[model samples]
Target: MTDFYTVRVHHRQKGTDYTLKVPDNRYILQTAENQGADLPFACRNGACTSCAVRILSGEVHQPEAMGLSPDLRQQGYALLCVSYARSDLEVETQDEDEVYELQFGRYFGKGKVRFGLPLDED
Candidate 1:
């Protein structure tokens, strides 16, 4: 049988509860997305620590943290993009700051962006 991990998310803002089931090698952020839940995330390859958070409980493995700083990792901080839940876990989102608010969307529903400023041509 395939192994799966369960996670319970306690939203700090909406006061909502979300439960998710993820495969053993899958990241928590993917699991949240699968359940139609939105957690903050960027640079989904761990090249940036933009998706870093505190692991309130459970175990996780980070293969490529792209210099998150050992001090931060020792303090229970984790980069959700490259981290996989070793067991049932709880994590804090980094979107509560006034400067960087997190708004997530379904992976399939992501909008496209066109580079460069608009130019007049007719």
Candidate 2:
């Protein structure tokens, strides 16, 4: 028998909430979208933070979510595009820029730019 879990999502920016019956084997975001929920996503393969969410309760398995660091994941962050519900779950949509910043803000403005092509150096 296939197991199903209740997935509740709070879209903070849109001030909306969605409740979905998600299969344990299925990706949460995709299932929600298939059911007509308007969730944000980009690079659905889990390479970006556009679909990032904060797990308010319960757990998810996101082995393919490469966009998030281990620390972030441990801190309850998840990339919904690649996350599978592991239990009845509650997640809050995060601002894309905010999550991106938390994920990579340390590297911003820290590296020197080599503006010109290496072969065209003056």
Candidate 3:
């Protein structure tokens, strides 16, 4: 038997709300999209932060969410593309840029660019 959970989503930027009955095994974002919910997403394989959300309540299992760090996931951040609800859920969509910065901001502006190909001198 498939267990379904009530998933409530608050889209911060769009000022919209979506309430969906999502199966425990289904990906929340995909299910929402199928039901005509306008959720943000890019790289549906969980390689990007476009579909990130902050878990306001409930629990989710996101073993395949490679875009987020363990610490971030522990802190209630989830990539919706690969997350499955473990309980009735309430989540707020995140700003892509903001989440991206939080995930990888440490690497930005820390590297020096090398111009052209370097030739080794003997």
Candidate 4:
């Protein structure tokens, strides 16, 4: 039998909460979208943090969450696009840029660009 879990998502930007019945065999984001949750996502390949969330409760199995660093994962960050429910779960959607900065800020933090302004060469 496929294990099903209740996954609650707190969408911070929209100030909405979505409750979903997720199965251990499926990724959370896909199920969520199918259920009309209208969540944010980009590059649904687990290589980006556009669908990042912070686990508020319960467990998840996300062996393919390559977008998250181990430290971030240890701190309860998860990429819903590649995560499967392991138990009843609660998560809060994260700002993609914040997660990206946390994940790769060290390597790409040096460049800043202003809109409509030409970047300095050299």
- Per-prediction TM-score, please? 0.67, 0.87, 0.86, 0.85
Q: What is the lDDT of residue 89 in candidate 4?
A: 97
Candidates in order have lDDT scores of: 0.65, 0.85, 0.85, 0.86
Candidate 1, residues 13-115, lDDT tens digits: the string is: 6677677887777777776787898776667887556667777898888878643545456777777778888888887654553112221222113442123
Clashing pairs in 2: none
TM-score of 4: 0.85
Candidate 2 lDDT over residue span 14-80, tens digit each: 9999999999999999999998899999899988789999999999999998777777889999999
Could you tell me how far off, in angstroms, the CA of residue 29 lies in candidate 4 after the best superposition? 0.4
Candidate 1 regions exceeding 4 Å error are 95-122
- lDDT for model 4: 0.86
Question: How much does each candidate deviate from the true structure in C-alpha RMSD?
Answer: 11.6, 6.8, 7.3, 7.1
Which is superior by lDDT, 3 or 4? 4
Candidate 3's C-alpha runs over 4 A off are 109-122
Q: Write the per-residue lDDT of candidate 4 for residues 55-121, one digit (tens) a residue.
A: 9999988999876777788899999999999999999999758888775565454554334122333
